[model samples]
Target: MTTHSLIVTGLAAGYGDSDILHDLDLTVPAGKITAIVGANACGKSTLLRAMSRLLKPRAGQVLLDGKSVHKTSPKELARTLGLLPQSPIAPEGITVADLVSRGRHPHQGLFGRWTREDDEAVRAALDVTKTGDIAERNVDELSGGQRQRVWIAMALAQETEVLLLDEPTTFLDINHQIEVLDLMTDLNQTRGTTIAMVLHDLNLAARYADYLIAMTAGRVHVSGSPETVLTEDNVRQVFGLESRVIADPTSGRPIMLPLGRHHVTQA
Candidate 1:
């Protein structure tokens, strides 16, 4: 890893009076993919926002490279950390290349002029995301999966060491979800990018993540390798759903099969 990235301690954040998160401590290993999973409203998105410096912590601190994130300049921070929220907006007429090029804003100078490095980064990001063929295409005209990939490409162009994503698989079908995760895995392996993503799909999380953090009601329920933390008992406790976790025949990692009421057999 080029840099030892984010360290968060006693981190608590939320909007207005209601406290969505209690004290939290987490250390993200550089260059590894960490997946955060939980039921809805478990502070998954808020945790990502806090680490990315979008949401202010009420009690504890989020440190990026040993420095307080609150003290870090936005441009400098942007250079080190990139975040992709669930749904990012592009201007109506924005081209894929134009939007991806905007990731270089952090690298710009006083006049914010574009540089060769910026152009190269944009092109490289497009190429890596496989959107180079559609570089001139309007972003609004793309499919949900393609649009998501474009947003990811824009984040990639920033060339940050640590990338955070919230619900990266929300709108996609099963195949595209796998596609995005595969792309992210490739990026992590190829560039040594440290990644932390919040995922709603437990199965996908287990399949793709190097590490998993299971959260419940704003606190970490358990964290470790998927095989360690994603057992049937843990799933029942954290997600409040009965499930049977078995080894995936292909991968050997944990695989959750939820047991719904309708699926229960009569005695």
Candidate 2:
């Protein structure tokens, strides 16, 4: 498995005339799981869009292995870096197999034909995501969890060294959230794929991410290991909430317990 480096420098991006990310800089650790967390409207999704080249940066650049992502050709970039956005829409009435097969487009030449290799890639992705049984079903017919897995399977079939996700767990229940995150972990561990994701749940981010990046007002507040970044002070600073940080017994990672006004325990 090959690992790739993704770096951002002086990134400033937004929609229309407003900048959601300002002079941001970051380096995604190679072959590790990174979670970007912050409060609502903190530019988490905007940062991800910039990194994935979905949103153009007004300043600086996103570099993949020292090359500018914005300068890379669409086919070449998609071959190397795969992105699953927050809400991926499939063509109405498309079957699971057909939608996943689209992932092979980057690998296929303009005049190329679909070969056995493509079939194997799709099959492996479906197997890994456990979506093979529903391959013939319409994407619109599946439940939310199943639909999310199918989208992930499409990304997996792309076989990129780097994968970026935007709030992959949004709209998922607790059980499904864990299921999706565990699937991502499996991809990271088994394929050595570099994973960067935006997550809203601080506890889940700390539990699963090897690195944590906390953003505020379109800038990174702090970033490091979960143990280093998920502190009481950091949470207070980043989320503006009083919270307790404790070691999770099962994973030995930090778990944040938010303190609210109703909880009447004076410190």
Candidate 3:
């Protein structure tokens, strides 16, 4: 069984007067992929933000390694936890290798020394993301898929134990989505990285996540394995849609078949 790497208790936060997350409690299992899924306004991004220390919780606490995130220094916290937002701006003239190497900034001193260890991490990240060939290419010149991989490689180079990614596959084609997800799975398996991602693609989330969290009205509706959470009832309640849940041919995990307006059959 995977140990708990991070824990949140009674977490609540929102924009101004509106409360989006209500006493949300969760545990991220060490070295496992935990995917959070819900409709818009369900506090998916808010939760991820709180976990990454980007947003301060209004009510409860987010604990990293049994210590409150509010107490940890930013640089110290970043050395243990990394966050990848849905969309990130890259420096206009930055090369792919340079962009990935920037991830080692946390390990650098005030003078920003470029150590041999930093170079090794950058190389390893490029190797993992398969972006070594484009190492010297300007990041802006790459396709959307290639750019996403570079961003992921940058996160890989951070060498943090926990990585929280928000919509990691937004601009990629289906194939690239699989490639990135597979890479994340490999990282979890080999390096014991605790990954939590907010994914809109239900089928892909089902295929990749070791644990699934369904949120409704700013609270955890239910959570468990793919087969357990992606049920017809849970789908209808959380997403306001009906769907057939079937086994994934490749992974044997539950795959949701959304029965939206376009997918509904005329009676």
Candidate 4:
């Protein structure tokens, strides 16, 4: 359980001619769960992409343990930093076992043969994700929840110290969403893996994340513990909506209740 630091400095990145992330600076706390929340197209995913080296930074750097990610070799970087994008596409007709095995690619050489360690890693990942039962099933045939678990299993099999997830809970039902977030917490608790993820559900993020980051217009508007970051003023400024922040009885974290036009109480 080696701890690794992931830091972003003056990161400016985007697609085509538009920069989605503007001079963004962030430090992912080592061995902690960090959730990045923001409105649509607020550069949460773009920041993640830059950190994982999927998108090249226009200006600035993403560093893993003080080393530049852009300069690191692909295999070397993948071995230390795993990324699970919002929509991961599997090869047509690939079986669950085969797909999970792909996570071992970074550890294998060009002519390397599968070893017992690879088998054990894949087995452990599948077991933890509860996907072992469907190991031989076709990936495309599984339900959305099952498919998402399999994708997570692949990331787990990679065994990276630092993981970046872009909307990992997308398309999941409430139960499945809780299950996935709980699983991530388990990983952090057991393996001390550093995780940074983009989440849309503010309450869920507050409940599960040790740290919360709220972004607006390609910059981090506010970030800290849930109590510090999920205040009424921050929510109003970040989401452009009136909301009340209350302590969640279950988790004791702040949960936001949006106040729309219809829900009004006379002063």
Candidate 5:
């Protein structure tokens, strides 16, 4: 498996006339699971978009293995980096098999016919995601959890060295969320794929991520191991909430316990 270094240098990007991400700098460690967590409107998704080349950077550059992503050929870049957007549009009536096959696009050359390698990749992806049973089913007909896994299967079929996911667990139940995160871990360990994702659940992120990046107001507030990045003071500063950070007895990761108005009585 090939590992690619992803870095952002002074990145600034957003919608027209407004920048959601400030002069941000980050380096996603090669072959590790890095989770970006933050409050709403903190630019976590914007940073992922910039890294995936979905959104053009206004001021700086995203580098993949020391090469500018903006300047790379789209097909070449796609072959090396796979991105599962927050809300990817599945073509109406497309089947799971067909959607997964589309991931082979970058690997196919001009006038190239679909080969056994493509079939194998697609098959492996579906099997790993446990979507093989629904391969022929319409993607639109699947439940939210199933649909998300199908999208992830498509990304897996891409066979890229770097995988970027924007809220991959969105709309998933607790079990499904754990399943997806576990699948990501399996992929990283087995294939050495670099995984970077934006997650809303701080506890889950801290538990699953080897490295954690916490953002606030368009900049990275803090980033490190879960123990160092997730602390009482950091939580209060970044989330504007009082909370107790406890060690998970099972995994030894930090678990946040948010205290609200009603949770805190006069002491």
Candidate 6:
């Protein structure tokens, strides 16, 4: 149950010539779930990519336990950090078992010998994600929800202490979104895995995240507990939307209720 620290210092990353993330400083609390939320193109995903070393930072560095993540060896980093991208591709005709087993690659040596531990890891991941029933099924053939869960299983099988996900709830229905988020919470609780994800749904982000980061124009507007960060003014300024923040009766978490022209009652 050792949780490692992740820090970003003066990080600037983007596509080619354009910088999507400015000089940003962030510290991910160990063993907690942190969600990054903002309007589209606000650099939520870009920040995530930089943190995971998928995108190179132009100005600064991402530090995992005080060491530069980009300078770490690929297999060593993979063993310590797992990333689920916004869109993950499974090779055509690959079975769920095979794809999940691929997560054990980091643990394997140059000889690539598969061990009983590998089998157990894949099985545990599948069972936890409720994808064991489809273990033999082709990943491409499953429904969107099932596919997403299976992909999560693969990440889980990696057995990393830190996990990063980019919009893990993308294309999911409300129920499936909750399912995946709840699963993430379970991972945080049971395994003490440090989880950081980019989420578009403000309400869901507030509900599930222990810490919420609100980004605006490639910079972090504010970050703290959901109740503190989801204030009306911050929401409006970051999202450019008029909204009311309410306490979710179930979890007592902050929930954003957008105010539209038609939804407002004239006094």
Which of the two, 3 or 6, has more TM-score? 6
Model 5: per-residue Cα lDDT at residue 163: 97
Q: What lDDT tens digits, residue by residue, belong to model 4 across residues 81-188? A: 999998989999999999999999999989869999999999999998999999999998998889999999999999998888999999999999999999999989
Off by over 4 Å in 4: 264-267
RMSD of 1: 1.4
Clash pairs for candidate 1: none
lDDT of 3 by residue, 1-267 (tens): 234369999999888888889999988877899999999889999999899888888999999989998789989988899999878899999999999999998999999989999999999999999999999999989998899999999999998989999999887899999999999999998888999999988888988999999999999999998889999999989988878888888879888887776856741
Model 5 lDDT tens row, 1-267: 677999999999999899999999889999999999999999998999899988999998999999999999999999999999999899999999999999898999898599999999999999999999999999989998899999999999999999999999988999999999999999999889999999999999999999999999999899999999999999999999888889999999999988887856632
**Stretches of candidate 2 above 4 Å error?**
264-267
lDDT of 5 at 6: 93
Give the distance in Å from residue 14's predicted Cα in candidate 4 to where it truly belongs: 1.0
Q: What is the lDDT of residue 140 in candidate 6?
A: 85
CA-lDDT, candidates in order:
0.90, 0.94, 0.90, 0.93, 0.94, 0.93
TM-score of 4: 0.98
Error of 2 at 16 (Å): 1.2
lDDT by residue for model 1 over 86-189, one digit each (tens)? 77889999999999988888999989887889989998899889999999999989999899989999999999989999999998988889989999999999
Worst 10 residues of 4 by lDDT: 258-267
